[model samples]
Target: MVGSGQLRLLAGTLCAYERDGLAYELQQALVYVDDLLVVGNSMKGINCLKSLLDKEFNIKDLGELRYFLGMEVARAAQGINICQRKYALNLIKDTIFLGAKPYSNPMDSNAKLYEKCGTVFKGPSKYSRIVGRLIHLTHTRPDIVYSVSHLSQFLANPTNLHYQVALRIVKYLKNEPGKGLFYPSQNNTKVKGFSDFDFDWGSDLDTRRSITGLCFSLVTPSFHGRVRDKKQSQGPQQKQNIAL
Candidate 1:
């Protein structure tokens, strides 16, 4: 018992826990490595939890969260905007496509990729590094999620074609590096989800599997969303997982 009530670690989460106070006040803390983010319905409750934590571990309060783990956070009367504009710019600079012409689309619909079709790329590490960074950028740039997912399948045996496609995505990022999600101030607690499946059976040339795309959002009267793509062997199981 930290103060008046018991503080319990929440199940199914890495390092998240909650503390309760008298009068039904509650606060929660999310710990990621050395960083801690605290949230609660009331400032008094949050402070109480922090005090308890400070007594146990030496912790520094970093004021309001403006940035964390490369994601930029900005708040206003309208809402909060999260983006990785600086990270995206740095990604572009690290690649050869900095001055390449921007494309309207992230991927080419006409191009189909196969495992053993193109000549193997000599520098697989270069392709892996860029694709890895692109995966991290997906935290704020959901627009490239599908394209990046498509290219990731080739990381182990990347080809010249795969490397070229990866560069194309970097070129596409040049169009609007600052593009990101916005959470409006006038939003409700309703959660919304959307999903799509590629009907083409041979979408995956190597495995002949189909790709399912899912998106989840908070209802801000507008959808602020994140996207995920999965390749599934069975339809019913994947659909059930999507339902949850």
Candidate 2:
């Protein structure tokens, strides 16, 4: 035989093995600390790999993948649906806006957020903590991303108005704690992108700088940005090379 007892490189966040040239068509074992998730296209191959792991180590077979890293997994004929309802509920419970009424929109269209106009928050640490948790919640809830990005601007010196808007975002979260993006398990998922920018929306009283909001989304990393600039002319012509 090759060896009597040969166990090598059995600890890692991700593990993959392939004897043939095909790598992506084979099995995959993803591990987060102690939680191990074995997955593959074919159920027969998956079970065989899992059995080897269980025999070598003492890993308990949880069978199917349901929940991992705050996201719930539900398998079906159409496709797999993922959500973070439990995580979102727990997040609401941990915050001060649990009992608050829900709202339809994450942000107020009439509300214009000026940086240095409102009264300063006495407890900025609390505001920062809430914003941090909200950022984590955005992992599954992209709907609140605009609101969270808006609130994050005032982290250095958050005002009462900013804090209120942050609470409003939490209230938005209360609308549907189970609401999350559905990622259909299929080949050929199309990618789409759109960008928008504002032209000197509001001018700061002290600095004379204007506010600009820019947003763009890629396949994975979707982000929005707020820029303070004095140049107001030809804002749209700046990025003419960007395709879409």
| Tens digit of per-residue lDDT, candidate 1, span 3-35 | 444466666222223445545655677666656
Candidate 1's error at 111, in angstroms? 1.6
**Clashes by residue pair, model 2:** none
Model 2 residue 29 distance off true place after TM-score fit, in angstroms: 4.0
TM, every model: 0.79, 0.68
Prediction 2 TM-score vs. true: 0.68
lDDT tens per residue, model 2, 1-244:
1142321245543333444455343566776655677766766557666666766665666556666777666565645555677777787787755768888888987777767858999999999998988898787777887779878878999999988888778777777776665544454544655554456644444455665555444433322221111211222322111100
lDDT of each: 0.73, 0.64
Q: Model 1, poorest ten-residue lDDT window?
A: 235-244
Question: Predicted candidate 2: what Cα RMSD to the true structure?
Answer: 14.5
Cα-based lDDT at residue 239, candidate 2: 17
